[model samples]
Target chain A: MNWILLATIAALLIPIYEAWQDENIWQTMLAFSSIASKTSIMILIVSVLRDDWTLGVVGVIILSVGNAALMLLAHIIRRTNEL
Target chain B: MSEQLYIIPIVLLLPLTGCMLVLQVNPYHALVIRGIFGAIAALVYVLFGAADVALTEALVGTMLSITLYAVAVRSSLSLRVGAIEDQLKAHTARELLSVLRATFSKHHLRLEIVPYTNLLAMQAALRAKEIHCSYVLSEPGGSPSPPGGGSRYDIQTRVSRLYEIMQAEVPPTKAYLRYIDLANPDKSTEVPIPEAMEGKS
Candidate 1:
């Protein structure tokens, strides 16, 4: 559990690093989705460890819904940019 | 200290580092950085056993706010205009530009004008979406106008959903515009000829 916490914490930096280095809007959105998924996974782990079903439900919602919103926004932006 | 005790440090340190890093990024990269900050904060809430706070951070902070920011950024609209070189050289064109600036500002849009040597090039730019619109003059030469004869401003914008917004927001330029054709620039080389003005004075 401790090692999982440490690894998730470490993984959090990857999106920040990618965002800083890449200037493309789509790439930035990709980084955001990555961050969202990783964070949801961390929440899920914490919920399982604590046996908190409510927290587990929240994590599931984020895991399922968050990336969809990001992808939709990215698509809209990209289409607008092409215009 | 117990190994479990170090979880507090991980929670505190990771989010703090993310916050500091976020502040260091350029504003253009802010969307992604903001999402990263929210994620880190949510993780911190989970570490503290505050599942409710974590959920709020994950949903509102991470997801909803970022989408709102994206929509806001999208609304910072800009329009590109390709002008015939002869048209831009006219005195009325400058006044038209100032009017455009005043009018477009009402809708929070910025207008950029790029001059092209010929109508064909201007039309091409508009068709390619390289420019949102093009400006053509009713008369090209420095001809003295007869009595009751005036210059017609033929501004053609790429037909889009936003065209209606632009039309509704048009400032009072010298001439009123009426759409005469739905001509596609790609297939048409037929240009609108300026009405030959008879010297009436």
Candidate 2:
């Protein structure tokens, strides 16, 4: 559990580093996805530590639906550019 | 106390450090940095055994807001043009480019021009979406679209507006208005998406 917390803290810095390094829209999107997945994983880890399935279910919902919404928003923005 | 308790302060401190780093980045990069900040906050929540709050942060803070920021970035306006070499050589075609520049400038759009070797090459570029609008010279009496046949095959979205501009501005030529089917408003040269991909979510 201690190692998991450390790993989560380490993973949280990646998007900040990426944003500081590059300004391209694609790079920003990749960073966002990395952060999303990492945070969801952290939620799953904490729920396990607490012996709580309800909290785990919330993490699972975010893991499945969150990235899809981001993808859909990207698609919509691309469509607006076409106009 | 368990050794895990020591990790809590470090976890909490990470977001504050990240916040300072985010402030250092430019506004465009800052938007991306905020997503990282949200994830770190979620991690801090997890360290406190507040799994529900961590889950909320992961969904609402990290993903949803990042998508919104990206959508804003993707809205920049642009237009692309493609033409074959022979068509570009025509005096009227150069005039057409000037007209296009003037017209698109009104919309504050940046135009990109690509030159191709032949009509087929231009068509291929159009299909690949390397360029939004393509121009080609067609010889009169070219039945199935001659190599240099004068025809502009445009995407459905931009075709009508382009046709209106061409009709009003471009001087009549021997092959003028030969290929575009203004007669039937619905026909498109490109094939629709495949059935298999269309059925997928």
Candidate 3:
């Protein structure tokens, strides 16, 4: 279980590095979406590890809300590009 | 008991992402990194046994605040320049617009076009502070200044900082740049055109 969480943290670094180095706004957004879902997944894993129901529920909410935020951001950015 | 090993690294990730967020130079890119920071913060909060705090951070900090800030940055970081509608279709107008875009982008400001039906309407918008600048096409040797009447273009800006910026970057030959002092009531805002100006937005 510890190894699983450690590996997930390692995977999370990939997107962070990508977000930092990429100059394109869309690419940074892509990395942000990746990091958002990955972090929420980590929260869920922690919940399962500790058997905490509240943490589990929060994880689910964050997971879904993150994607919705991404959708809103993408639309605004697209309008900017068109204009 | 041995689980303490990964906790240090997980907590370390917080500062790592935080640093990246601070290092971003562009406002739009910074906002995206801010979302990334909020996500990591929520995860760290949950790790520290603060479930409710984590939930608030993810919802308000990540989702709600990011959306709001993105909207604010997109709108505020732009310079609104008004132009007469029909004159904008001219080939010279296109060249002038490209030059304006190139100059403004260097300062991280986006140029937005606000079209008005006529010269009077555009001047009114500028005096009302609805636009930061206005582009006028004057007639050859300077008169009437009908839409696309001449190659000569006039760039008028009420803002001093914008005037200074353009005064340095935009050459006088390309377009005649003027700084209008709106505070002085005596200064004429009127162009010599005789109601011949027409444009579309």
Candidate 4:
């Protein structure tokens, strides 16, 4: 598979997925995910074009689990600091 | 040359080449030489529209290389002092005999141990040598005998030279030890004396 093309397709489709969610809360979620999705797609393209299998696997993991962990950590830290 | 794009790789390799060259030179020369090369690289980067990278290289390269040079000079000077100390430490009986044997094998003048092989012993040996210098390990705890003991005129001259070399190379703290002339002076020398002996004399 052409990884650059796949990455380009993913970058385009993510916005559509965000758009399908409700206009209020989902809009905020979409805005946040958009940054993660863009970074992931860029890393994915670089990894595949460079033929770096480790980077390709790690980039996918970061795009999935790393983004979730970052968001969760940010939320917890913010709430604790507020208290 | 449509392949002018290869210039990017060449430009990136300049710092790596500079680093290798600096590593091979005497550390004292590394700072000034590296800074000059780095400045040329910065200028090249600016001409090629990498002003941001150029600015970073100019500031960091100049400051870091100069700092490294200063540290290297200080460390080399300290090492010289440490070498002298090691020679002195070997003046104990067993080592003294070994050193005397070695000296005889290599030198034209015969080596001799005069008086006692203590700090005062150094003065005697230095004076005793007509064609070569003598080595003495200053004994710990004894009061220092006067400077011109055995051959005052000859020993004084050699001691003065040794002191000059030591003063120039050693750091301030270690330099003070060379000034004492006594076997056990004070704790002023960066070389630590035992706590029990500190206030005794």
Candidate 5:
């Protein structure tokens, strides 16, 4: 498997494991969000290192969108529980 | 003018001379002295038609050397943690003694115990314009104590501001931050612990 795929798999599983171990939901959410954001940046770094400018640009754009979505989701979840 | 060809080697020797002089003397006092000599040497070389050599020597010998020496001074000031702590403690004791000696002091005074850590000292020094930057060591899986928890948050915020400053002042390639965990010294360990039975003879 590609390193990116392996990283994504690890990122996805970490939150699940934390949740299973009865960790706080907010902490788990933060971990997941941080993982997503970091992974996107890591992919961009790898692409640039490989001299793949196109892939790097795409990775950055995707990362920006992913971060915004994650932040929005976190806010909504936080707000819904308060209501 | 074939005899003047020897001037090229002399031009190269100028920076070497500056290096040796600076190396022998303490940099704190000798930096300006070496810089002046180096600049004069570079000017002489430029007059001799060695423009490239002159330019490099002028930059590296004078400007870069002075900047590096200044940075060293600042780093030394910051890294003298033990001395700073002793000074701070002495100052505090003197202040308290003065307070005790005063008559008719009605104000309820509380002694605020400021925890003296390397991180705290660095931050104070930075704020006081004593040092430009300092590194903080963090360990993985380590939780902050109650008072330190707030201090840790403030340190992170300071670091983020420092990052912005570095990005503006330095080139993108040079503007980088690294977190080194001193507690967990080795990063290549596969297993944290070996099987219990493996240790049994």
Candidate 6:
């Protein structure tokens, strides 16, 4: 279980680096999208390992809410360009 | 704490992204990095057995705050320059526009073009402080030729600070910088936000 968590942490680093290195806003956005989902999924895995129902529920909510936020942010960025 | 070795790495990620956010030169890019920071922070909260804190971090911290900040940054980090409808179509105006855009972006400011029907309306807007700046082709008799010997544009700005920035970066040959001091204290920038809110309410 601990090894699984370490692997997830390793996976998370990929996007953090991408976000730091990419100069384009959209690419940084893609990295943010990746990091948000990855963190929630890691939370879900931890919940399953610890057998915590509350943590699992929170992870599920974050997963869906992250997508909603991405849409809102993308729309705002698009609108700025049109003006 | 051998069983919690993963906690060290997870917690360390917060500072890593924080530094990235701090180092970012662009406002829009910094906003995206902020979202990344919030997501990592929520995960850390969950690891510390703070489930409700994690939920709040995700909903309000990451979701609501980033969207609000994005809109705020987009609107605030902009420079609006008014030009006459006829002036914008000219070759030299377009050249000056490109130069202005490049100069402003280095300071993380976006340049926006507001076209007006005529010089009278454009000057009115500038006097009312409706626009931050305006430009018009210089008349040969009105102003001497720049050393480069091409037609020049006058970049009139009410902002003293903006005049300084433009003065430092924009070439003298492309445009002449003029700072307009609004003598009427009542009509200057101080009152518009509250006045508009009062009108709406």
Kindly report which residue pairs in candidate 2 clash with one another. B137-B148, B137-B149, B137-B150, B138-B148, B138-B149, B138-B150
Q: What C-alpha root-mean-square deviation, in Å, does candidate 2 show against the real structure?
A: 14.9
Alpha-carbon deviation at B69 in model 5, angstroms:
3.3
Chain A TM-score for each candidate, in the given order? Answer: 0.89, 0.85, 0.95, 0.48, 0.66, 0.95
DockQ values per model: 0.27, 0.25, 0.80, 0.01, 0.01, 0.74
- Tell me the tens digit of each residue's lDDT in model 6 across B36-121: 99999999999999999999998999889999999899999899999988878889998999899889888888889999998899
lDDT of 2 by residue, B84-127 (tens): 77667777566666766676655555566677787777666655
Per-residue lDDT of candidate 5, residues B1-201 (tens digit): 543443344345446545545553333334333443444464344434454564565456555665566555433422111112333445433443243223112221212223345666756665554443343322323322222122111112123433443334432221123222224535312112124412331
Candidate 5 per-residue C-alpha lDDT over A1-83 given as tens digits, one digit per residue, 9 for 90 to 100: 24543354345345434423333446645554554455455445445544666546545654565455445445544542341
Interface RMSD (one decimal) of model 3 = 0.9
Q: Write the per-residue lDDT of candidate 4 for residues B4-69, one digit (tens) a residue.
A: 443444354456536544554333233333443454454345435454565455445544544555
Comparison by TM-score, 2 against 6, better one: 6
For candidate 3, give the lDDT of residue B2.
Answer: 71
As a whole number from 0 to 100, the lDDT of residue B19 in candidate 6 is: 96
Candidate 2 — which residues are off by over 4 angstroms? A11-16, A73-83, B3-6, B13-28, B69-201
Which candidate ranks first by TM-score, i.e. highest? 6
* lDDT winner between candidates 5 and 6: 6
What lDDT does the true structure give each of the candidates?
A: 0.66, 0.60, 0.85, 0.40, 0.40, 0.87
How would you encode candidate 3's per-residue C-alpha lDDT over B1-201 as one tens digit per residue?
678877888899889988888877888888889999999999989999999999899889988898899888888999999999988799989998999899987787999999999988998999999999999885565532335434667889998889888878875556767778889956635333333342310
Off by over 4 Å in 3: B143-150, B185-201
Fill in the DockQ of model 2.
0.25
Question: Relative to the unseen true structure, what is the C-alpha lDDT of residue B68 in candidate 5, on a scale of 0 to 100?
Answer: 64
What is the C-alpha lDDT profile of model 6 across A2-82, one tens digit per residue?
A: 999999999999989999896688898899899999999999998998899999999999999999999999999888767
Docking class of 4: incorrect
Supply fnat for every model shown: 0.50, 0.52, 0.80, 0.00, 0.00, 0.89
Off by over 4 Å in 6: B147-149, B183-201
Q: Tell me the deviation in Å of residue A58 in model 3.
A: 1.3
Q: Which stretches in model 5 have alpha-carbon errors above 4 Å?
A: A1-83, B1-24, B82-201
